[model samples]
Target chain A: MIHPLAVSHDFGVWVGALLTLMVFSFLYRDNPFYKFAEHVFVGVSAAYWMVIGFWTTLWPRVIVPLIPEASRIVSSDTPLPERDLSAVVPAVLGLMMLSRLVPRLSGLARWPTAFVLGTTAGYAVVRYVRSDFMHQIQATIGDGVLIPAAGGGWNVAESLAALVTLSGTIFGLIYFMNTRRGGTVTTPAARIGLLVLMVTFGASFGSAVMARISLLVGRLQELLGDWLGLL
Target chain B: MKRPTPQILLTGVALILVVAAFMAPPGDGSSGGFAGAVTYADRHFSSWFGILAVFAFLLGGASLLRTHGRRVRERKADWHYSAVTLVSFLAVLIVGFLKLGGPPGLTGDPTDASSWLTTIFDSVLSPLHATLYSLLAFYVASASYRAFRARSLETSVLLGAALIVLLGRIPVGVTLFRFDSLSLWLLKVPNTAGQRALMIGVALGVVALAVRMVLGLERGRGGDGS
Candidate 1:
């Protein structure tokens, strides 16, 4: 007497299949089911992050340190120091951050925002300079282009690769430079930079495609193998 | 000679603390007292900021609820969707809050293996998230087809490179076209070079931004899109 519209009885499979189909339905056109699924996903994810943040971070680091009793309740096994006055600084800053909810007091929120920005900026300067800039430059310049190995044989391929890298990097940077009038030399450098950039972009796009396809394949396998049991 | 406003004072204090925390030397297990305090403060600053972020998240949630609640109340167009959104938000929130089907403790993790929260996460959220992300596959394929037309020399080079790379990643291309070597050479030389250039540029840009913030020249609460 069950209608053909009924889904399978397996709880996990049934729920998963419904959600998967609902999401995939967007391929055809937007509709109510997709909207509902999308909203639920967003809502649940937000809540998940909140709950996770509270349990992992705010509770232990901020709250428990302020109200010593919370430390025992959150984690009974580990012994922690009673009160940390240092936590009060961030706590106050956090409260200041909440002032953004009020229109007039929103200006107060800028303090915490600036704190975060300053921290990120200060840290990023050192990190990016050391890792991205200095390290890359060192790697590029340190390659043995002219100097042969201890064996005294010249590596033709290694030399060619090093030369290409040095030139490509130089030209790429030149291409990014603006506000200067291009000369005959700079024009050729910029064009070579463009060619290098195109190749990079192409490789990036191809890698991205492969990654997306893998994700699609995962969902398809879930639908076929997990829910449908058809493998 | 002018008195600094509360905002400026607060910003200054924040900057000093953050910079101090960043500059604090790592503890080598030999030091204590002020060194220990500095080490502790340095470690906890990020988590303190995380707590602050939680408050921001709370405001975001409150805003979401307010908007959806208003829509549902006023019966605006597509208000049914708003109702769905609110119900969904509340359902997940309440279930997690109550720790339904979870171990009996006030602060017991709601995401325990047997809990409704975990069930919803595993069965509903994971699949929905995966499927939604998978839609990018179709979009990328379509976009690549439309955008990678070989109308010019640069475009042709790009298209050809992309095809070679794509084929190289798969098994059949190695069997037929011997694309692996070409792809490797292209990636190792030009791609790495281009990436290195971009990284250096980005690092410099980040340094500039950081300097501006530290100097109080970036006056938009860091939210002002530059």
Candidate 2:
């Protein structure tokens, strides 16, 4: 059967199909076409991200706030007429980061780097404490182990599940204990922890595989449905 | 001493920012007082960071150009591929900047969907990224096959869990033995419990590291203990 792509002259689809094939060629062997495609991919991706960074982030956030009039020029959704002096501080700090590209002035970059590090560290502490620590502990503690049955008594399966989960969590924590000497409590808990960790890793691996397969399916759909029109 | 001064100042700024975050008024957008000033400062600093992060992309681009340029200049093996890399980089950059095939105006957005930039991105970069990511499917299949060998008790448990998860997620397993329910139980209960433990530990570690950085006990940027 003649493919629809043979008749229709969609240049964009053709280009996409060819590039997708070029990338897939790596599965057979590392050829020049694959290398060419790989490098182009890297270059274009870097450029694309930079374009997004400038247009979406840097231009509006740093420039427009300081210059305010740039809002009109850049087609900013919200036009602030008054200049914000506060915006100038980050611009200066950002310029300080760029100074590292210069020879003698490289020391200036540390200020921005330090600022970034500090802010990130500060930000992470708040987020991690609230979400990862407090929320997780709260969930663990508040996990309804004993579900009320239809008649009146607690559900045995749910209670067992709760016990297992509590045991798994405790054992997982015990596994990370560095100073624990081999003992009745520590050894058994450590063993259970290892088993729990192994199960977790396996589940993670399975999920990762599923995700990759979905991507593969997507590419196949593009090739067959879009390019070949076989689907 | 010179290096330490900047480091110290940056640390101080971080601490102040953190403290300000806590002290800032809950939802006062009017810019009334100290809360307003703190909010203003916070935003400016954040924007500066965003701008600098964008500039880092330039450094990355420069590095790419330098690598390929050197290869082209030296006439190294497969130097033609280097040429391809450099040419594509320049082509995309110039095309995007000029807004070639964009709307007929100087004010046209360079990255407008209708522009050549988006066309190249859609046809080339998107496919390339998708294909590259999809290649992991082949690698993962092969790797999982190799890794799932039940060499010992620990390995057996791992293999069992992996197989259960893999099969249970698919339609056939769901229809055959209600493995989906079993998988869900494993994932929601034991898996979540294990993950929570790990996350709590990681959070504590992060808090410690952040405190160290704020105290200026940890080295800032170069990590040379400055």
Off by over 4 Å in 2: A1-8, A69-72, A75-80, A149-152, A178-186, B27-38, B41-44, B102-106, B109-112, B220-226
Per-residue error at A130 for model 2, in Å?
A: 1.0
For all predicted structures, in order, the TM-scores are: 0.86, 0.89
Best by lDDT: 2
lDDT of 1 at A120: 68
Using alpha carbons, what is the TM-score of model 1? 0.86
Per-candidate Cα RMSD to the true structure, in Å, reads: 4.4, 3.3
User: Which digits, one per residue and each the tens of the lDDT, describe model 1 over residues A22-77?
Assistant: 99999999998999888888777777666666666777788888888776764587
lDDT at A78, model 1: 75
**Model 2, residue B156: displacement in angstroms?**
2.2
A1-231 per-residue lDDT for model 2 (tens digits)? 754553226798888888888889999999977887898888788777777777777777777778888777645455567776766777787777777667699777777777777677767777898899989878776856776778899989888888788778778888877325553335766778878878888888778888888888998898888787777
Error of 1 at B170 (Å): 2.0
lDDT of 1 at A85: 68
Pairs that collide in candidate 2 are: none
lDDT of 1 by residue, B64-114 (tens): 888889999999999888887788778877777666667766457776897
